[model samples]
Every structure is written in structure tokens, then in C-alpha cells.
Target: MRIGITSPVVTAVPGVHSPWERGAGIEELGAVAEAADRLGFHHLTCSEHVAVPADVAEQRGGTYWDPLATFGYLAARTRHIRFATQVLVLGYHHPLAVAKRYGTLDRISGGRLVLGLGVGSLEEEFQLLGAAFEGRGAVADDALAALRASLSRREPAHHGEHFDYAGFVVEPHAVQERVPLWIGGRTPRSLRRAVAHGDGWVPFGLPLDRLREMVGAASLPEGFEVVLSAGRPLDPSGDSDGTAKALRGVSEAGATLVSVSLAAESAGHYLEQLEALTRIADAVAAEEGAA
Candidate 1:
């Protein structure tokens, strides 16, 4: 039962954004990455959005850092921690382009990259990017196949409904023989995609029972990951025992990797919360080991 963190202070959401995050800069982001690495977190994830429409900016909050660039920056700052895109919208970019960007990221990060891909929900953003908003599921399915082909070989080729390319080598091929591809979402179609194509399932906000049901339905291969969001702050008020219980429940519920998010007022507060969460995770792991 490994633990990962959704990178804090990078995406600003109303009610979720800490006051200090508004003033935070790149250095602060580096500090958080470094802290997650030092604290033994399995992975640090960043969200992505090429652009947010003005009408939805109020609800979505318009401050999304480019995941590829952000991860590149963090790669230099962290050693052991894996970097992930919490969910990169597959319909927004060409498959080969994504393959190249993330493949290079994996190469530079020493094979520590988890590609969490999704068919995005924002219709307006899709319109802005000129990516077909409707039939995005089909688009994502094709894109996933194309990405698989492209990332696995130096001279890759793919012929799909949306993309076609061949005989072009993607240099500096991914460090991992097969980069772990995680599909994200809670929809039935999403679950099917995970079972059919993904190396892992990355589901957010699903209840424990629902998570177990979904995992049972999927015919995951051996070592296939089920990464679930913890769905709440581990220590909302510094309750380590409570945090441990919550995490243990998640592990028992069949989450191979649990992603924990913390709400903090400052970098210092975020680091403190991370340390507390790490202790709770370690305790849970120790008990599991003993059992």
C-alpha cells in the first residue's frame, strides 16, 4: 500500500487553495517536490489544462501549470519520488507529441513517471483547443493505443481514426520498458478503458464500496495498480490515529496506491501535514507487514 500526493499549491481552487499559495512561486513548488521526495512519498502528481475558458474559470480556477514543464523542473529537484500527471486530457494533444514529451520526462526522471490520462469533461476547453468535445471517449481510446505504440518503440508507427504516423523515431525512448499508464475517471466507460488498456486505474472521489466494486469488475493484470484518492485530508486537525485508520481502510479496500491531498495555509503547513501523513502511512504499512 504505497502513498502518493497530489502536488499542492500548483492548482488553485476556491475554498481549497491556501492563502500562501496565491503568493507562491517556482521556488516554493520546488520545495514541496523536494519535501515529498525526502519524506518517502511514492509519487508527486500535477494536474493539467492547456487553457480554461473564461466562463468556467471562476469554478475551475485558471491557474494550471503545464504538467510536462512542471515535471521537468521538479525532475532536477527530486531523486526518488515518481512524478505523475494526475490526469492529462488525452483529446487535447497529438498522441506522438504526448509520447515524446512524457517519454523524455521518463528518461530524465530515471523512469519515474506515471501517465494518468483522461478524456476531459470541459466542453468549452475542448472547443477552445479544437479537439472534438463529443465522442471524446472514442478519441481517448484511440489516443491511448497510439500512445502505447509510440512510447514503447524508438521508431514508432500508428494508424488511428484521429492520428497517423510511422517510421519517425522518438529519440531518448522512455526509460521504463512500459511507462505505467493510468486511466482516470469514475464513469463506466472510464472503467472499461482502464481494464482494456491502462496499466492502472486512477479514480477520484469514489466511495470505498464503489471502488471495490469497480476494481472487481476490471480484469486487471498482475501488478496492475489501482490508485485511489483518499477523498479527504488525512489529518484535518492533526489526528494521526484517525489518519492511519482511514488509510488502512483504503488499503483494505484494494487501493494499491492511495493519493492524499492536504489543505494548508503555507508551505510550512503543507510540509508539516506531509510529515504527519508519512508517519501515519508508515504505521499502517508496519501493521500490514506484521499481519
Candidate 2:
């Protein structure tokens, strides 16, 4: 099993809203990325959001660096670890622009890019980007189609309900023939989209059984990925080795990767959580090696 960590978005603010508000600064993010790389993690994911929702805006320090730029920053600092967008909201970006940006990042990072794509529910973000919030689904579908077509050929053409283009070869061709695209969302439609266009499914907020069922029902291509969130504290009843034990079950369930999020309290807390993750990763790696 591969292990990864989520990068904390940095911003200036106090306890204002959800944990999303308390993103860390760029310096902190760089340090964490370096740390993860040295400690044997295989991937690092960054979240994207234009603004925090009104209700949680203050409590959550709502600033976010453009994911592509942030990944560039990370690429300069780390080696070997793949970079990912935890979920880049499809509606907020032009598909062609995203394809170009991602392709460049993949080249800059030497083929280490994972595109985790999602639809944003934040209407404020849509209004800000001049996108129709109601059409996000259609937009995402079209974007996925465009990305696939454009990335495959020297010159590609696309004509879809929401996006249409002709005669463009996204240069700096993705270091890989295709950057691995993982669909991110927890809806039936999302599963179908993953089956049709995605190389993997990255689901959040679902229990183990539900995740298994979704994977079983989804018409995935052979070698498709299933990555589960592993940030929240597992029940403490399993003893000192419980974390490793739980990770083993997840790995046995065919999770190609597992990402653990720290309960952000302070730098110390975050680092402590990362240390715990290192131990778990070591255990999991050993199990996989033995297998």
C-alpha cells in the first residue's frame, strides 16, 4: 500500500469555522512536503477552494494558493513523491487551461502528478469565477472529456454540450501519456463518472462498508484505484498496535493508497500526527513487502 499526507492550506485567522479555515502558511507547507518525502510517503495532496462559505468563513482561514502554483512550489522542493489536488473543483477552471497547467506540472515534476477532480458545491466560488453553479455537473463531464481527448493526441478536437474546441495540442505533453485522474465525490453519479473517465475513486466521509460497496458496484477498469481517507482518530480500543491493525484491514480491502489527515491544533500536534503516520506507514510497507 502507498501512503500519502494532505498538505495544510495556510492562512491567518483564529478558530472561525471548520478546520478548513486554519490552513498553514507556504513555509509550513514546504516543510511538510519535504518531511513527507524524506519519510517515505509516496504522495502529497493539496486542497483547492476560492473562498470559504459564509457560515464558516471567519473560523476557517479561507485563503488558498492556486493548486497548480502550489504544486510547482512543492515540485521544486521535493523529489520522488507524487503531487495531487485533493479535489480541484472543475467548475472554477477552464478545461483547456487546467489541462495545460497540469501537463506542465507533470513535466516539471517528472511525471509525478495525480489529478483528483471534483464538483464544487460552493456557489460563491461559481459566482466569482463567472460559472453557472447549476451546470457544474455538465461542465465537469465536458471537462473530463476534453482533457482525455486533448491529452491523447498530438492535435485534438472536442465538441461537447458545455465545451468545444479544435486544433490544439496541449504541449509539454504530460510526462506520462496521461496524468492519473482520480474522481472525487460521494454520489452515485460520481461513481458512474469514475467508472467512465477516472483511473481511481477518492471518497471522503464514508464508512468502510459503504466504500467497499461503492467500489464493488462501480464499473471500474482493471487495476483501478480506491483511496480512503484515514485522518480522523480510529477508536482507541485496539491497543498500541491498533493503528497498524486498522491500516492492514484497509490495505487488505485493496486500497492502493491511504491518506491520513492530522487534527490541526498546532505545529506540534501536526508533527506528532505525522510521526504516528510514519510508524503506520512503516508497518503497512512491511506487510506489503511480505505479501
Candidate 3:
């Protein structure tokens, strides 16, 4: 399995975020990214939320680094590690805007971008952004279709029920002939959408057993990725056996890409965990090779 991080301090979700993250900024973030990049980690994520409702801020993470800015900075700092937007709410931006802004990012990063998109559920935030709240799933489907046609093309055109465009040139478009798209959600419909419209599925908040059954039953295409996370933070430095076992379980549950959060109280501790995890992964690979 390819290992990645749901990067620290990028999105401070309640109960999940560490206390030290409240004070951490880009310098600390850069160090962690640089270490992961050097360690051969596959990807790192930043989530997107334009704004959260005051009442729901504590429930949904109030802190989100806009993916574009965060990834643009981190991309320059890291060479091999890919940048994944854990999700960008599909209804919030037009397909062309995503194509242009993220396309520039792809060009800048040397084609190291993965677009993870979702049909968002925050009704208040949707209204706040003046996005159409109803029938968003259909809108997202159309948007995905448009994105597929336009992501790498300079002069792209698409005609669909909800979105249509032609005669527009997107300069410095995505360098990859096909940029990876990962759909996000925890439901069956989300899985279907990923199969129908995306390259991978990034499912959150599902139990491991449920995840196993869902992925096992789906008619996934060849090389379709199931990117999954552990139920809780892992302590690779302090608890290598447990961390390794948890990572193994994630793979057994059918994750082609495994996203991990570390048990750390501070910036230094988090970097320690990254190195520890890499050592453990190397050890496991060595043993498997010997077998």
C-alpha cells in the first residue's frame, strides 16, 4: 500500500487535532512536508472549506487552509510527494475555475496534483456561498463530466444539461494527460459516483468492516484506488507494533492508498512519527521480500 498523511495543522478538526497545532504555522508545516517528501511518502492532503457556520464550526472543522494556496507553497518545497485536496466542494466553483487554478498548480508542481471532490452537505455554507443547494448531486455529476473533458486541454468544450462551455482557452492547463480525480463520501452513492466519474474513492467515517464489504462488492476498474484512513491516530514511534498492525488492517480493508494520522503532542513529535513510520514500513517490506 502507498502511504500518505492527512497532513497536520492543515485542517484542525475537533477532537482529532492536537493541542500544539493551534500555534503551528507554515514553517512547521514545511518541515513536516519536506521530511515526508524525503521519506518516499506517496502523498499529503489539505482540505478546503471557504467558511464554516459559527454554530457548526466546532462540529465541522472551522480551520481549513484553502487547498490552492497551501498546495502551491508545499509543492515548491517537496519534489516527489504528491498533493491531494482531501476534497474541494464541487458546487462551490465552476469546473473551468477549478481547471484553471488547479491546472496552474499542476503545471507548477510538475504534474503532482490529485483532485478529490465531493457533493457537499453543509446547507448553511452552501447558502452562504450562494451555491445552488438542491440537486447538487446531479450538478456534481455534470461538473465531473466537464472536468474530465477539460482538465488537460487548452481549448476545452463540453455540452451537458447543467454546464456548457466552448471557445475558451485555458493556458498552462494540467500537464498530465490525465490528472487523477478521487471522489469523497461515506455512502454507496458516493462509491457509485466515483466509479462512474472518477479515478479513485476517498471514503471517510466508515467502519473498517463496512469499508471492506463495500470495496469487495464494488466492480472497481483495474487500478481503481480506495484511499482509507485508520479509525484513530497511530503512534509509530511510541507504539510501532500497534501502528504497523493498524496500517496492515487498512490495507486488508482494501486501501490502495492509506492515509495516516500520527499520535503527537507537538511539531517535533509529529516529524519523529513520520520517520518512525518509514522505518517500520521498510522493515515490513524487507520481511515480505525475504518470504
Candidate 4:
């Protein structure tokens, strides 16, 4: 199983943010990215939100970094680790714009980009951005199709309900022939969308039994990834064995990739937790190989 991390300190959720993160800036973010890279984590993910409504800011902890800018910055610093937008709201921007931004990011990052996308849940945010909120699922489906076309070819073309363009060249095509598009969300419509359009599925807050059922129902192609969030804090010192066991369970439940979040108070603490999790991942791989 591949292990990835939703970068700490990047999106400061009330409980997830470390004490040191209040004063932390790009330097601290770089340290965390470097540590994950050095420790052999598969990918480092960032979240996105253009603007948060005042009512939701408290719950959402409104400090989201632009994924393109953040990943572009980290791409220069890390060599092996991939950069992912944990879930970019596809409805918020034009498909060509996303293609231009993230496709270039993939080229600059040496093809290490995974475009994790979603229809987005925030009605108010969509309203603020002047994006239609009612039929977002349809919008996202069309957007994904347009993005696929735009990223795969130098002279890209697409004709759809939401977007239409042809006979125009989109230069600096993505390094990968097809940048992986992972759909995010756990709704039935989301799962259907994943099976139909996604190269991977990223489901949040899903229980093990439901995950198993969903994975079984979907007709995933060979090597199609089921990426799951660990959903709880990972504490290396308190329960290393328990962490391994939980991850092993996730692996067994049909997840090809697991993104873990660690509870840490400082950069040093974060690195230590990453090292411990790396050990756990290595052990899991070894055991799986033997099995």
C-alpha cells in the first residue's frame, strides 16, 4: 500500500493545527514537505478554498493556501514526493484555467501531480464565486472531461455542455500523458462518478464496512486506486502498534493508498511522527510481500 500525507499546517483545521503552526509560515511548511520527501512518503497533499463564509470560518478555520502556488513552491524543493490537491473544487474555475495552471504544475514538477477533484459541498462559496451550485455534479463531470482532453494533448480540444474550445494550442502539456484525476466524496453519486470518470477514488469519513462494500461494487480497472483518509490522529509514541493495525485494516479493506494525519505540536514532533509512520508502512509492505 502507498502512504501519503495531507500536509499539516497547510490547512489549519481547529483540532488538526499544531500549536507551532500559528506562527509557522512557508519555512515550516517546507520543513514538513522535506521531511515527508526524505522519509519516502508517496505524496504530500494540500487543500483549497477560495473564500469561507463568516458563519463557516470558525468550523472551517479559514486559512487555505492556493494549491497551485503551494505545490509550485514545494515542487522545486522536493525531488521524489508527488504533490496533490487533496480536493480542488472543479466547479469554481474554468476547466481550461485549471488545465493551464495544474498542467504546468505537472510539467514543472517532473510529472508528479495528481489532480484530486470534487463537485464541492459549500453552496455559499459557490454563490460567492458565481458558479452554479444546484447542478454541480453535472458541471464537475463535464469539467473532468474537458480537463482530460486539455492535459493530454498539446493542441487540446473539447466540446461539452459546460465548456467548448478547439483549434487552440495549450502549450506546455502535462508531463504525464494522462495526469491522474481522483474524485473525492462518499455520496452514491460521487462513487458512481469515480467509477465512471476517475482514475482513483478518495472518500472521506467512510467506515470500513461501507468502504468495502463500495469498493466491491465499483468496477475499478486494474491499478485503479482507492485512496482513504485515516480519519483519526496518528500518534507514533502512544500507539505504534495500533497505528500499524489500523493501517493494515485499511489496506485489507481495498484501499490502495492511505493518507494519514499526525497529531504534532511542532515541526520536530511532526518529523518524528512521520519517521514512525514510515517504519509502520515499511513493516506493512514487508509482511504483505511475504503473504
Per TM-score, the best of the predicted structures is 3
Across 1-291, the per-residue lDDT of candidate 1 in tens digits comes to 588987776788665667789999889889989998998889988899878888788988988888898999999999999988988999898988888888899999999999999999999889888889989998899999998888857898999888788979888778788898999998777878987888888887678988888777767789888888776655634777778778887887789998887877688888888887877777788899999
Q: lDDT per model, in order? A: 0.85, 0.74, 0.92, 0.87
The C-alpha stretches of model 4 lying farther than 4 A from their native spots are none
Q: Which candidate, 3 or 4, has the higher lDDT?
A: 3
Candidate 2: what lDDT? 0.74
Candidate rank order under lDDT = 3, 4, 1, 2
True lDDT of residue 111, candidate 3? 95
- Candidate 2 weakest ten by summed lDDT: 231-240
lDDT of 1: 0.85
- Listed in order, each prediction's TM-score against the native is 0.94, 0.84, 0.97, 0.96
How would you encode candidate 3's per-residue C-alpha lDDT over 75-175 as one tens digit per residue?
A: 98999999999899999999999999999999999999999999999998899999999999999999999999999999999999999999999998999
Candidates ranked, most accurate by TM-score first: 3, 4, 1, 2
List ranges where model 2 is wrong by over 4 Å. 10-24, 58-61, 152-154, 233-242, 252-254, 263-276, 285-291
Root-mean-square deviation per candidate: 1.7, 3.7, 1.2, 1.2
